[model samples]
Target: MRHVSGLLVLAATPIGDPRDAAPRLSEELARADVVAAEDTRRLRRLCTDLGVEPSGQIVSYHEHNEAAKTPELVARIAAGDRVVLVTDAGMPSVSDPGYRLVTACIDADLDLTCVPGPSAVLMALAVSGLPVDRFCFEGFPPRKAGERARTFAALATEPRTMVFFEAPHRIAETLTAMAEAFGPERRGAVCRELTKTYEEVKRGGLATLATWAADGVRGEITVVVAGAEPVVADLDTAVAQVLERVAGGERLKDASAAVAQASGLSRKVLYDAAVAARAT
Candidate 1:
């Protein structure tokens, strides 16, 4: 029989406006035997703001100490103490700490649940003008230009709306790179300071957003990018386009590879057809 570890409650704190705080969150904070906070000071401030004093022992649970804390937390839960995990904003483990400890609890067969509350990802998607029926949450864009560009390129064919967290200072550079990877005219929204006093949501084509962000952006940012439009697979048309490129002094090999890559066709077959067409 597996050991029955105590409950692990993953709680979501308000991203901005304190009124969004759910009653369940308050109850969990006050009732749990141990409270694991990414930032203990922030958690105290939150409790102060919400008028809910935590009765449990509050401990720091953030990235820096997460590795060392997980086993200890799991052990505490195994001893039958309910542990509540919270972050500065949003839920624990979404580009935040608590994921490692959650895994430990799962591995130990510990009881686990969430005190659901505000999430910046969902809030941004809800307000983003882009399609929301299907969407993906990418934690954050890479910092380096080349790495970030490659990351966007990998999602070039993704047809679901994409959400990404980003730093205020990096928004302009990131948007510019996204414009290049996803196309200048692709639609997206820059949701800033979500639910805060200075909240702003800017919707426009990638190019336009890039231009606007160049002047700079501030606040907690969530960027929603429209999925890449599905390419109509027409190999015959692709071959003709390749031939056109060839006519413009492009090598047959380069044109064939480009068309085949974009259309998911056979490069060798495209090259053969181009050769046959030239002979005719």
Candidate 2:
């Protein structure tokens, strides 16, 4: 029997500027057997901007209907359709629709690929002036005030840069919550309208950013916050804590390593001190 070819293509759309759309995106959009879009209207506008008309069936695949539509799309792909998936902006499945379809395709053992393009998270982090060596993309903070506060507080000790998306209207309240939870002096950057004509990146302490957004900013917002500084631990204190844990049945080496990690001290120093104390 001749093998039938099938594939699922996830194409990333430009976040703000149409010019950032990838050339491969236009090619796939034009040649695919099925174009599943988060918003068919937005896809049409994008096609107009790219100057490429999709020569395939365009179907609506969004949050509201994805659960029901995924099976149909999977069946079509299983039968040799080249289905291209595109969200309203940025890559699909990154705080966007298409995750279900992708998982569905995986379960069916179908081939899949992606058309790379612009990402608001990367763009924001790059311009945020924070330490980008290590970072975390925290989609969107909780909307409710209490939940939001609790969430930020839990991440207060995070030692890697953090990135988040926020609605323009809620930016002020969100920033204020961040200020209270992560400390007003904690530095952060508010990137608005990235890659667009009115692009702006405001870098400063979290409190300052909160005050700036209090005046009511507009457009897409991406915030990047610097990581918490490592806690400086005293050698005597860390050794005592390790010894206490060891007294509670943990191995001396294991206790020392755990205490060193929590206190940001040297594991070797902690272990040696604990051993010395035990010997004495």
Candidate 3:
């Protein structure tokens, strides 16, 4: 059994529009004993905008300081202080700085709660027109080109739709890498400046989206990519695909590796499938 001394509230702040702030968010900010904000300045601005002055103690809690701050916040919560955690935008802990603190509080057996508000994740998915029933969020790909390509290669065969957050400068490069690694015709959407005045959601094949992003883009970016289609049970197609890559100068090992990486099957299994395919 676990014991909790005080409530740990994970409050969601508006991603862009202040009007999207829920009523409960204001109440929580006003009533909490300690408010842990990713950016205390932003939180103060938000409070000013909402016409609510937080009577609680304010502390900065972000990626750079989360580790050091978590234990202290957990202690406060354990001491029966009502702690409310808020990020600069969207829900805390979703590609943001709230997970560690929340996990710490949980480990300390503190009562946890949330004041739900607007989320860019749900908003982008809703407008993406992609299959959202089954999906996963890949917070951010590796910043380096090679690592990013490898990461996408690993996900090529994932059956469920995938979402990713990317920086503006890297969006085009990432899309191009995805197209090359996952196939040019894979369906995807690039959502930018979600919920803001200049919001945009471009939907098309990965290759086309890559071209569109090549000209340069700005603002926050969230990409939703369609999962690879089921592997063609017909061994002929699989072998043909592998052979084409091999014929195009890719080594047999590299071709097998690439195909298998994208298709979610063992390389050995794919090699066997390729051998059987060649024999026929």
lDDT of each: 0.90, 0.93, 0.88
Clashing pairs in 3: none
Better of 2 and 3 by TM-score: 2
Question: Per-residue lDDT for 245 in model 2?
Answer: 91
Candidate 2 lDDT by residue in tens digits, 1-280: 4325989999999998999999999999999999999999999999999999999999999999999999999998999999999999999999999899899888888989999999999999998889999999899999999999999998998999999999999999999999999999999999999999999999999999999999999999899999999886999889899988988999988998889877889899889988898899
Best candidate according to TM-score: 2
**Backbone clashes under 3 angstroms, per model:** 0, 0, 0
Instruction: After superposing candidate 3 on the true structure, give the runs of residues whose Cα lies further than 4 Å from its correct spot.
Output: 1-4, 235-280
The predicted structure with the larger lDDT, 1 or 2, is 2
Q: Which digits, one per residue and each the tens of the lDDT, describe model 1 over residues 1-280?
A: 5656589999999999989999899999999899999989989999998899999999998889999989989989999999999999998888999889888888888889998899898989999978999999998988998899999999887889999999989999999999899999999999999989999999999999999999989899999999877665676788799999998999999999988777767889888987887788
Per-residue lDDT value at 201 in model 3 = 97
lDDT, candidate 3, 1-280, per-residue tens: 5655588899999888899999999999999999999999999999999999999899999999989999988888888899999999988898999889878877777789899999777888899998888998888999998898899888988888899999999999999999998899999999998888999999999999999999999998899999878764444566677889978998877888878766656788778777676677
Poorly placed runs, candidate 1 (over 4 Å): 3-5, 237-280
Best model per lDDT? 2
